[model samples]
Target: MTLPTTEDRDPQSIGLSAKPDEEVLAHILQRQIVALEAARDAMPQIAGAAAALHAAAASGGKIGYAGAGSAGLTALTDCLELPGTFGFPADRMRILYAGGAKNLMTLAGVHEDDSEAGFKDFQESGLGSRDVLIAVSASGTTPYTLSAVQAANDAGTETIGIANNADTPLLREATHAVLLKTPAEVIAGSTRLGAASAQKAALNMMSTLVALRLGHAVRGHMVNLVADNEKLRLRAQRILQDLTGCTPDDAAIALQNAGGRVKTAALMLLKNLDVDTADRTLALHDGNLRPFL
Candidate 1:
């Protein structure tokens, strides 16, 4: 059997260990650029996946992520940030990392081979037809990730597979396949280098597009962001100011009255609506500020 390109050694790195420090670092940086290009190549598939994810979220459905090792960490980073970044509900996101949190410190390679664990985790995640799952694997054949995608398919849940290899089971089975054809890793099978970069870039695009479609992002600002910190509170203020041309005091008052929700505050100021009416009107428009603006 032919090894996947991710496992194939790059001829350019034949003497990488003996190279000068600058040359070695330059090679690594160039490979990262290539990985990002791979993500750019998958824009169409990423857009489709984002559309599906947006549909699921709009319909009050959950989003799940499954992976192992480096891929799992990438997915976890994206999953955990959704709520704070876009005001997506934390309860609506599920993570199915192989070996769960107990093994996160080590991320044992053995866990990636545990197909049963993957299937069990997916079954217990409560993801159904209304939900969507994104599974990532460099080789596109990791047992744990593949099993989770298969289980999701069986449950009639939409799935987006992000893989570095071509024609693998994950890609063939997933509802939307995002193939990130990253170059072979400089360290051969160590996909954490280039493959992880491509996966992260692809996921970033997908999630950002979903946020834009949901109207959580407007004019490049994260309008629906959960301003739970001082920095974010300041950002919320700025967004209100930029969008409404309101004074700092007026923006602060609107933010307070609207419970720090940028969209609600914007509507309250822009439409001359009271706080209660603004909140209700924003909800009536499905939290989409574009309609009100």
Candidate 2:
């Protein structure tokens, strides 16, 4: 039987270990570039998925991510950061990893084959017609990931499948398929390299587009980011200053008055409104700041 492209041995792997350190590093970097290019090639699919997610979020729905192994880690990373990065609520996100938290540290390969666990986990996530689920698998054949997508489909949730290989079950089953056609791994079947890179890049693009569509991002600024930390608070102030052309002190005061909401603070400064009015106006526009800006 012919191996999938993701499992094929790359010619570049020949003599890789025997090569000079610089040559080995260069080959790895080159393959990463190839993987990123594959992600770029899937931009249309990613955008479609992002549109679905944005609609879901707008309607007060959840976004769920499912995967296994390195792909699962990538999905988890993206899921965990949405709240802080775009002010998306943590409770509105779900993660359906194969083994739950039991194998998170080890990521045992056995869990990837547990289709029942995948289906059960997704079912228990409570995501339905109003929600979106994104599942990632390097080979597009991991049983766990595929099952989660299947469960999502059965639950009437929109599903997006991200995978490295072409024409596999996960891709076929999903509502939207993002094929990141990364080249055969230099390390031969070790998807942690190119495949994981492509998945991460594709997910990053998809989520960023969703944020933009939701009006959480403005002029490349994460205006709706949760200012929970010192660094993020400083960033919120900077965003307020840059967008509203307000002094640093004014930005600080506005942020305080707006409860550390960068978008509301900007609106307050730009429209010369009180905090309550700015908040109400933002709500009137569905939390979008573009019209006020």
lDDT of model 2 at residue 228?
Answer: 68
lDDT of 2: 0.90
Relative to the true structure, candidate 1 reaches a TM of: 0.97
Tell me the tens digit of each residue's lDDT in model 2 across 1-293: 88898999998778888989999999899988887899888888888988888899999999999999999999999999898898888999999998999899888999999999998998899999999999999989999999999988988999999988899999999999999999999888999999999898888888888888889999989998767678988999889888988899999888888888888889999999998898899999999998877
lDDT of each: 0.92, 0.90
lDDT of 1 by residue, 79-122 (tens): 99899998889999999999999999998999999999999999
Candidate with maximal lDDT: 1
Worst 10 residues of 2 by lDDT: 224-233
